[model samples]
Target: MKKFYYTLLALFFMLPACTKTDIVPFTPETDNQLLEYKIVNVQGSPIYGAINQQDSSITVYLPFYLQLITLEPEMKVSDGATVTPVSGTMIEDLLDLFHKGREIKYNVKGKDGKVKTYTLHVQVQQPDLILQEVSTDADNPNTYSLNMNLDFDSFSFGLDGAGFAADLDMIRVMLVDEQNKEYGPLNISTFNTTDLTRLDFTVIRYKEQSDPILAMLPAEGLYRIRVYSYAKVATTKNPIRINLLNKK
Candidate 1:
């Protein structure tokens, strides 16, 4: 019995020592907190939105971006961070677009991370614009001037998104006849993609060199404007603007 008691006491003392073992210090990994990223346009199109700034810097188009992260405590970017607005852009215009997109994220660095960015959908809001047929020559209703109604001090994107350094080759304009036949590739003379609710698009009258006189077409016929924007592959939405005067 005495021998057993001594052994038990020795084991008890050992247990206490085992419980107080020293631990090694931990070190966090040092690397750019990035998993994967993507850039897209407002039409929910995938693209590598970028711009070559003549000056070492330029604002580029990023209709939207997403990040796939493995950790949560690790942040990527913050919300409402001052992003380099797309080059040739206005803060007010960008803000309006961001607001319309409803999902905006800041490109952050280090612990100031935003989150496991799901999908911050930015959109190219139709600039608040309206197209009107104002005739300088009252004698000829066919001769009219296309006027633009714009309300902005600063904005981004251009008419038809051209000259803004975007992929314009993918955009086009079309004109459909009464039989729905097409005739175009016409230059978008006056139109805008700025963030607006309404905009004056273009003025068209019978031009011998350009458009055939309305009287030449079927006196009793119909027509439509087809806008095939580059966004979808198998499916495309047609925003048809018609001749309100001719339509019954």
Candidate 2:
């Protein structure tokens, strides 16, 4: 009975040594990343930014009409991460600093106090008016033609009327032959502005126009249609090829 009592005392003393008093405290997460970014509340449309993880940079393509001063970007970051120049903050003053050809820096700090910086690049997407469709006029098959699907709203006109003035903008229709010879730079001066919502060209009088080449039916060949603007040059990515049947 005395030996069993001594064994119990030894076991009780050993329990204190096994108890862990120096427990490792929980460590805060160290994840700091700018996951998603986008510009919102613009005049036309919201522009989404592309995040490059390799270089830790974000790039956004802003339409020419939208100014940087009008941007209020929305951002998403890693959990428990805080961003400076917080989301939805107007960047008018920041724009002044940006015009100096400097990248805007966005800093994100994690719960662990580790910070990651990301640079933002803003690029202005140029205005392009594509030739959507072209067809022969039914009323005057040989004399009149119609141009369709020209987006006038895409072009931004400045306060001083620097861009896309109806008076200055014109459409050129050229006839190309197998020999690559060009004929008739038929210019359409009249534009259909009755619909102020979306301005467009209505009809092209091939025979009635003053251009002598357009006075008669264009020789059977490939006709290329292009819109011209003094403020900005127009480009046609896909040139249209149509066969105009001579009036019976």
Q: Which candidate number has the best TM-score?
A: 2
Query: What is the lDDT of every predicted structure here?
Result: 0.32, 0.53
Model 2 TM: 0.38
The lowest-lDDT stretch of 10 consecutive residues in candidate 2 is 152-161
Q: Indicate which candidate wins on lDDT.
A: 2
lDDT of 2: 0.53
- lDDT digits (tens) for residues 109-204 of candidate 1: 334443221223333322222222222233332322221122111111112211121233333444456466665544543344443222233434
After superposing all C-alphas onto the true structure, candidate 2 shows an RMSD in angstroms of 13.5
In candidate 1, position 128 carries an lDDT of 24
Error of 1 at 62 (Å): 14
How much is the lDDT of residue 81 in candidate 1?
32
lDDT of 2 at 170: 31
